[model samples]
Target: MKLLSLLVAVALGERTLRPRGRNWVLGVGEQGPAARPPARLPAPTLSAPAVSAFADPAGALLAGLRRLLRGDPTPRCEMSRFVPLPAPASWARSLSPEASCPRALDGEWLMVSVSGRDLSLSSLLRKPAELQPEPVLITMATAVLTVLTHTPAPRIRLGQDAVLDLSFAYAPPTPEPAASLAPGPPPFGLEWRRQHLGKGHLLLAATPGLHGQVPAAQEGAVAFATWDDEPWGPWTGNGTFWLPAVRPFQEGTYLATVHLPYLQGQVALQLTVHKPPDVSLTPAPLVWATPGEAPPELLCLVSHFYPPEGLEVEWELQGGPEDGFQKATGEKWLSALHHHSDGSVSLSAHFRAAPVTTKHHGARYACRVRHQSLPTSGRRASVTVEVAGLSGPSLEDGVGLFLSAFLLLGLIRVLSGLVTDCDPQEKVTASTPPTF
Candidate 1:
């Protein structure tokens, strides 16, 4: 019975584990068909923070999920992606936050909230119809999400709470142009004349509102003659010039130019010349006295016609005779005497007597008179005087007489004292004794 039980156990075990033609089963009784290969799992997607250092894991995941469910297309999840959103309808109100708020749009809040949701990349790209392809918006939204999630946000200071106030500074503008200095009329017109009173006399005058200023001692501004084109006066002070006495030069019209300092233009005047009054000598033959032991007298008479009041006259002896006598011990000759008065002049010669005599026979003398009115025109006369006799005895004659008288007196005294004594001294003495 034990042998039979062993055989049956062996057969059951063989049935449980059967091997195919060349393959035999050892440990397990029978093996089903070879185990099929295990299925391959897909690679795990990276979290937002793991993929980009700047992304926020929770926010990025939420946004990606929201984008996937809303049939929105997923954008490049890289931090480098940037996009711009549509212009807000309330842009004007946003610009001025201090002012009153304006009305809101219908889907403005929904659109902004949807932009914050997370989305799966594949599911979000499946429906391109429901999702608008706005590359700029997607890029901008991704960039903003990335910065908000991974970077520390900066705080904005608004209104009066801000620390520093800013403004622009500028300078004031310049003024416009204007005129300067007061205006007036030009200088007054001037006029003048030249009169020839004498060789050295001149006169000038002007119309109203014109006067004469003294010329400089040095050469003043050059003056031109009205008639001729020549330059005149830069005259010295000695040259006589009178403004009130302006008259003509000769028998013709005279014109002159006068220059005053600080004057704008030359002064011109016209004058008519009139014939001057005639002057003559009363005693036609001007007689002169001869020079003698005593000075001789010279006399001359002059007469003037239509003589002006306060007419001044002067007399002078121009020259004397060519061979008039001269003394060895005194001046060669005496000058002719001169006499003058209101309108007439008398030329007189007076001899200053000296011890010496003079020979003045047939000596000629001249008398010259000058009138104040007619300075250039004057009268001159000459006369001849005869000087008689020769020179007197000299001092030598008196000396010779004195010497002769002295010699005669000496001879008489000598003869009286001497007597004719016969020769000896003894005989002279005896005669005197016998008489006594």
Candidate 2:
């Protein structure tokens, strides 16, 4: 218990002293390194000009005019410095103005360069200095732009409507060096340039303006670009802009590019439009079986489909004692259907009976297919079930029957010979028989 109390006391002490040590660490308190004395700036010298009342009055007037002209205290001119930022994926920096406009971070920040000359007269009072202008350059103001584009591919069906999305938000420039003082880069604007969506196979309906008002006529290119004249350095704020709804009539890849005219920076994205699958059902062949054999399972083929490439096939049986042959629901009756390499699916239903009886002899088996293309009545195909087996004597049984009949006829003939002609040679002696 004593050790625990001691640990608690130590923790409290640390907590209490931690705040006071911050000043020492920052070099602000006496506990820290001694602070360096501030540098001394030269003081401007002022002395009454020597003016003799008897001197030339005209010279005094000229001197007074000169002093009044320089009285505004040389205007401070500072040079503006621009730091080349890392180029974005689409924009390039350090290019000649004619080559391409430099790009700023999308909705993030824009650094501006300013050039000015400092005209402080304090130097004139200290010593005779060269009459050259002092120019200072610095990156003073930063403009921020927010860029947003449709994520992923804007996927749609060939005939479906797709809206291309590209938008940006421009935040007010950072307050630094008075807004009126900093001369930033030329106004930056974003506009849609071109589309490679086939040869007019895709049609665009309208190009919307900044106020969500569409233009009078449909345009091939859409621009969200607008100029800002607030002297805030040509940065315009556009909340959101949508590309005209486009209907793709072809199935292929398409691309669109949005550009920042001032920076020559562009953002491009690719869109994919797919064709709906063509679905078809093949006629299921008739199922046949023997009297005591299992019926062959029936198959209905759904072919020529794409994109999804697979479909569901159902089996419905009709014509049994209950006025309908109920489809088998057990797992044993159905086989899992898989798509072929060629993107075709074939599903089959197995029909079985412990001992196939005549009750299921004429049942009709139909396969109903389900796919995007085929509608209600057109997806079904039926095949009749037939039980046919040959009923005829076997070769071994026929041979045995023929042999038995022949043996019986032979026996009858032998018996008749013994009864009527037993003694061909002694048959003529009728009197001898009588005497015996």
lDDT of each: 0.25, 0.36
Residues 381-413, model 1: lDDT tens digits: 555433433233334655777887888888776
lDDT of 2 by residue, 1-436 (tens): 0110000001101111001111100011122112222111111121222111111111211222123224423211111112323333232222223443333222222211111121111000011112323441211122233233432246554444555554333333323444555553333433333355444322222222222322232334333444344454424333123444334322243322222333222233355553333333233455556666666644444443434443556666687444665764322354555555543334454434333556656777666666554455446677766666433444565788899999999999999988786775566776465553
Q: Where's the lowest-lDDT run of ten residues in candidate 2?
A: 1-10
| Candidate 1 Cα errors over 4 Å, as ranges | 1-264, 268-296, 301-358, 368-379, 388-436
Write down the TM-score of every candidate.
0.19, 0.31
Cα lDDT of candidate 2 equals: 0.36
On the 0 to 100 scale, the lDDT of residue 300 in model 1 is 43
